[model samples]
Target: MSADSKESSVRLIITGRVQGVWYRAWFMEKAINLALSGWIRNLNDGSVEAVVSGLRENVEEMKKTSWSGPPLAKVDNIDVGIYKEKIVNSGFRQLPTK
Candidate 1:
């Protein structure tokens, strides 16, 4: 889809052994490579939380990839919420661990 036609953002909470397994770094790489913009961080509850904003297809791709996570991550579940949001120029980033 054209960049201008894309309009969606997804907040994802991934559970399991996601923290301390390079999940953030791996997600950053994937997002950047897909030309997606968003932020990812570790939660105090041992889950990895992320917000991906971009084209609908790209955001969906990100969610799909997140389900597997890094090889070291044992993803047990992924909870997602979709919302309408304006697209921004921000690049992918790994936020401070919580």
Candidate 2:
């Protein structure tokens, strides 16, 4: 498929008081609700990282919402990365801390 019309995918690294919180779990639920597929995990630097794939709007919405996170989270920043890969629907998951 052409890159322009391919599915959208985003790699987000969320910083701040995100660990020890329910961020990963909550993000998984939200991603699923948006019918997205990808993986989420805690970074060794006390940040949260996720690679979600779905429609452009859904992915963008989720990315915006990630900055706020769950009620207990104190998100400071969310870094988005650009990658070259097709988004395959593989279902969302929470992975071990990296």
Output the number of the lDDT-best candidate. Answer: 2
Which pairs of residues collide in model 2?
none
lDDT of each: 0.84, 0.87
Best by TM-score: 2
lDDT of 2 by residue, 1-98 (tens): 34785468889999999999899999999999999999999989899889998888898899888887889999999899864576568899989988
Compared with the true structure, what per-residue lDDT tens digits does model 1 show for residues 1-98?
34466557888999999888988899999999888888899998999888888777988888888888788888999999964465475898888877
Off by over 4 Å in 1: 1-5, 84-87
Error of 1 at 14 (Å): 0.5
Question: Residue-pair clashes per candidate, as listed?
Answer: 0, 0
Measured with C-alpha atoms, the lDDT of residue 45 in candidate 1 is 92
Estimate the TM-score of every prediction. 0.87, 0.91
The parts of candidate 2 lying over 4 Å away from their true place are 1-3
